[model samples]
Target: MVLDIIFLMLISSTSHVSANSTTVLPAAAAACSNGECQLRDECSTDRDCAAGLYCLSCPLEFRGSRCVRSTISDPFKLLNNSLPFNKYAFLTTHNSFAIRGEPSHTGVPRFTPANQEDTVTQQLNHGVRALMLDTYEFKDGIWLCHSFKGKCHDFTAFEPAMDTLKEIKAFMSANPSEILTLILEDHVEAPYELSRLFRSSGLDKYWFPVSKMPRDGQDWPLVKDMVANNQRLIVFTSDRSKQETERIAYQWNFMVETQCECFLFSCCFHLWIGL
Candidate 1:
């Protein structure tokens, strides 16, 4: 059987009529107030829809697109309960930390774009199991950012990375049966900084040791086992050296992706275990 996999690559927080500006259509404004739109509610943009829903257009189904649930079912709960971790799929959110309406931390207006409208907690609550974060060294600590030159400036900085990590830790603590993954586009240069962040955020408590990672295209450990042992958090870093130095897994070594081009900035893909 061909299992469906979803890899949500964030492009814009909401639908737009132009590449540089976002405008909510009149239909959305007239249909519902922000955060009030529910399933089947008429919407012209994602901002007009409530959390866990997005505006989508279907020419054949109805006259106009209505708010629809953008959620994923827990594969483990619906499918096999004891499958290898690789056998299951996750709803992966790209640039999960670049959230709209996030307050400025540098006392300057944010000049970067937002990729998501929901908070990290909300994403987790909506069943997003994997998060892709762009991390950089900023303001003497690691921060989430979207920069042009791989260096985080005040205008590009979102928030301190610890804030989001702690949110993940809290979610896992409250939901003991869930597993989460973090894929980092790492830019931190300091030694052991990520290690320190993980520890301080209390996420280290659920750390999946790199030693247990498959090395020869082998199936990952059973998801049930990972959850039962409380080793439910899997972290992957872009920097290969960090694998040995920080004891975090290198993303390329463990996961393979097949992406499809959809737009200039947005795309989706399937992630699979790789040799």
Candidate 2:
């Protein structure tokens, strides 16, 4: 019985040692080193860190790894103290309306041809400050090839749209004093692929998508380089969550620090206003 007690004690002691070995103490994180640190994932600025964790400098407005930033008092401040809505006009083909048939005796106005330009002009008169173009090829008389009944035709085979864009660009170039903001959607492909298309079209001075936040960090060096190279592409991010907004804001702060143009595209305009 005495020998059994000794064995039990030995087992208990072993168990205690194992438990102690696995126990972790919560304390201040360590300083960052060579882009490595204890709180690396959570580190945005030195202020976000505890005693041991290395505090890296965050871009303007960004506070921490969680990417917290204060809201601007005015959305117009984002557009160089000018209202984006007032400074430019938006033009697009998607919003154009078509008239399918002749007017009937019932007094419904009908026409055979769609007056795309007239519709766009009306929108321009209403104060649209930017243009968003959907560049996907249409198939079978459908602009969206993925849709039903569009599989038989290819839209990219046509050149009229490209020519039209060139004319518009030329016109905008002539009126350089007017602010011209162009928003391009990639239509179901990675942004990098769209970058190639822009390059091929000689449109390097447009906005492109980036995965990095606009701050002076390892992740943003490429974005800085692109800006330095006069790529003329602004970084636009689409964020859906508060956490994501924080992260995007941090990156935006970094971009803002570098004087790069950054914009956010969100579905929840109301929520963004609250923020």
Candidate 3:
């Protein structure tokens, strides 16, 4: 009876060992097939992976064989240390009033706010890269704010606008890998006041333009000074005359030659360049 009990015990122990070995073998093989022993956790591509391993996707700001994080400190670092001057342009499609003719107008037209928003959305959807908004418009023989033009709209004060501008600047600072190029088009405004407003708003870092032709007496010295101070600002002349066009071409060519950035007239009818 004692000999029979010993034989039964030996059989039970052998069976247990066999079951454990069967369970462990597949797991060990899987680990080996995944290259976990050799590559550890670092992998770039599927080719770098073993039979059971696969590639994983990385963040948008990152680019590498292994989908590793990027080393770039800032996301919005401008390419070539300058904005693409003439690569894009835009023309405002919606007027303050409903009336729409050409982009340039002598008086404010009646336009619904909802319609303007819808138009902006459509332009954005149709690969419109930029938008130009007439911040101030000449109406009733007086200059009126386009944002609040024909309606009793509750608008943010200048201080709040400045604060919002700071927040935007902070966001850009945080996301340096992202691109945020805004061109402020000052339509028939005093350069000094516009520059002051931008500076107060903490948006002086962006490229801004003051229209030159309509305000004839103004000098380019302010623009030059702004540019010299590492502020991206340019002078824009309307396409009024053949001589003017030639002058623009010459000035544009000089800017290009000197590696200075400037915007040009765009072919797209509805799009306008803006900040």
Candidate 4:
């Protein structure tokens, strides 16, 4: 096995080190035979390294100090460090008003409020940045319904979609550093109505225009950059017809998701094996 020697370059806390400068550690505290380790390197344990940077023992995969950064990474940490939004393995969730309660790849959501404990505001307070909402035209008003079985059932959960949008708008205003993604299980007959709701809800200002989007699976803009430009919100609907108009993005175009067929097959295969 090849040992990749790690080098540590440390300058005095009160002084700067130039290319020609050299400082030596006392012989008693040095652990590295090659004389490269400073305060933190070639460690017997992780306490030698600075806070948050665990020591990486070369080659072997082990617990604690024996860890290596070559293959290990937390995408969420990367995201916080200003990787593009599309690079986030983590997402924002929103718990605004809705009956859809999120769904599977098959677009199926529970109509009975199963597992629907938090309202949209509560979800937002708890760091949820994604919202799964259902949109419908009901009773002469645009409402969010827990539509199941091919129709919006009156007995299921329901609320005005605008009310929820208001909550999201307020949250965004209060938390300027945060970002959100809206996933709509769109069932409204008029594709343009989605635009009207967004506009009226005061969310149109935060809309990310299609023209700025990267094409062909290209990288998305950085989250900080998006926030700085006030394009901190992402909206996606299942309705394809509504896309590229009034800034309501289509989910199929934006999300690289597993097809419904493949997802179902994988689930069924797992179930069969479990049995």
Candidate 5:
């Protein structure tokens, strides 16, 4: 499979906190060290936990970081896989491509980031299923920038969107059963060129065709269907011209209008599609 190739091409390059990995408490619970946690009995920080557990502060139902699981449970995993992709809710990030005030782990250097310190890969790994990205044509590349200027910031700088996207591709390659949605605020003069990035990153293989997508008010295909066929990646853009190509899906046509109003340039949503 094409993903198999991508997996190999990027496997050695991808960097993420493995799911099975654990960490220490936020602050010092008591300055506990490996000696105290060696038996998997005590943990001062995430690193103090054993190989399988992470540190979490919980109530009486669950105590200590490594001793027990979190009292909370992830509801999304309990959803029926047979439901259409749109029927389920997803987590999304605003300024998905921008970092808070530091450079991203997988993007170009920048003095100032959009709003978050975490990179796209970090967000995705943390369970954000959708992203709100601003796309603009910079000096030679299509980069992610903040503001209507669509150019590098006065003090901060724009990051090459492709870099973030390639990492996204890497994440998708590794997590096949998951689905991702990209909502792009278009500021680029030309949108068709985005396809080049898709091809270059090898994400085109995972592209969910707009033709196959459901219209507003229409139900979407099941998550199993999308994952089974490897159509787990979906893209939507504010620029309608981009829709001329197979890679970009015009957002309004697919996601119905909602009471949650947004300006033309803003792309982030609390939860945009499905119930």
Candidate 6:
């Protein structure tokens, strides 16, 4: 079963990598109509908006999109980082690698649908704590893809899995207080390849061992403890057998998931509903 949501993280600290990172909220920007627009203020470009917002347009909603909140509340930072890992909610991006305007491979324009408009690094900077990635064994290696008929053709492939994992590694290094979860829709048939991929990406240093995961319904380790130990990366694979063979956490054994299929707001959406 290919899961639609993969990783979750406790976003507690800011990264120095974001060029637009700022905490200042100018008082005059609220009234200005030309530039430096605040929330609910009119804007024409992303630069015209404040730090955490961007100019957006919706054909059905009025005429244009106003500055809206893009960052999620950090429970760890708001209260404390000592709480159990599962005690806080996280923001997740579905099919994060199916990015819009991604350059085509195989010298052919991609016909597959795109699921995201920003890069993985941008999503992380914007407080997206989780990412859903579809991994398949293609072209002799694991690649991020939008699987069709359970196969990853050249047209559907996004990029090598290592690229995104390296991005995560860089983000983790820049923000030491954060904890991330990666949920993999495992289609890779190669034995132990997943383990190698993480190691090669330099993410192995932060791997959260499966032995530490709770089998029964129980609280996870404190966010502070995970950061201190540097076991900040939690990975889950859909393939059940990997739990034993590759030492990767089998997602279903730990949590219950229901993928939301509806795209419209009026349509019913499924929830995680807990373990």
lDDT per residue (tens digit) for residues 1-275 in model 5 = 00000000001111222222234444324545553443335466767655444454434223554433212222247776787665565556667666655444335555553555466777777667777778777767777777555555534445677888888989998987877878888877764577777788788889889888764345677778888999988888888877876448887656532334444333323323321
Which ten contiguous residues of candidate 2 have the minimum total lDDT? 1-10
**Candidate 2 local lDDT, 121-146, one digit each (tens):** 33333332334333343321112111
Q: For model 2, state the Cα shift of residue 33 in Å.
A: 78
- Best model per TM-score: 6
lDDT of 1: 0.77
TM-score of 6: 0.82
The TM-score, computed over Cα atoms with residue i paired to residue i, of candidate 3 is 0.28
Residue range 1-275, candidate 3, lDDT tens digits:
00000000001011111111111111211222233433233455555455434443333212332322211122112233243333222222322121122132333343422223223333333222222233332332212234443332223111122333454456545533222322232343333443354467665554343332112222222322333444342322222231232222112211211112222311112212112
Between prediction 2 and prediction 5, which has the larger TM-score?
Answer: 5
User: Cα lDDT of all candidates, in order?
Assistant: 0.77, 0.29, 0.29, 0.55, 0.60, 0.73
TM-score of 4: 0.59
| TM-score of every candidate relative to the true structure | 0.78, 0.31, 0.28, 0.59, 0.65, 0.82
RMSD of each: 8.7, 24.8, 26.3, 16.4, 11.2, 8.1
When 2 and 5 are scored with lDDT, the better candidate is 5
- Worst 10-residue lDDT window, candidate 1: 10-19
Prediction 6 global C-alpha lDDT: 0.73
Candidate 6 Cα misplacement greater than 4 A, ranges: 1-32, 36-42, 60-63, 258-261, 264-270
Give me the candidate number with maximum lDDT.
1
Q: What does candidate 4's lDDT look like per residue over 26-108, in tens digits?
A: 33434543323343344554555444344554232232233222222334344473766664543233223532443332243
Each model's number of backbone clashes?
Answer: 0, 17, 21, 8, 9, 4
Question: Whose TM-score is higher: candidate 1's or candidate 4's?
Answer: 1
Name the 10 consecutive residues with the lowest summed lDDT in model 6. Answer: 13-22
Kindly provide the TM-score of model 2 when superposed on the true structure, using C-alpha atoms: 0.31
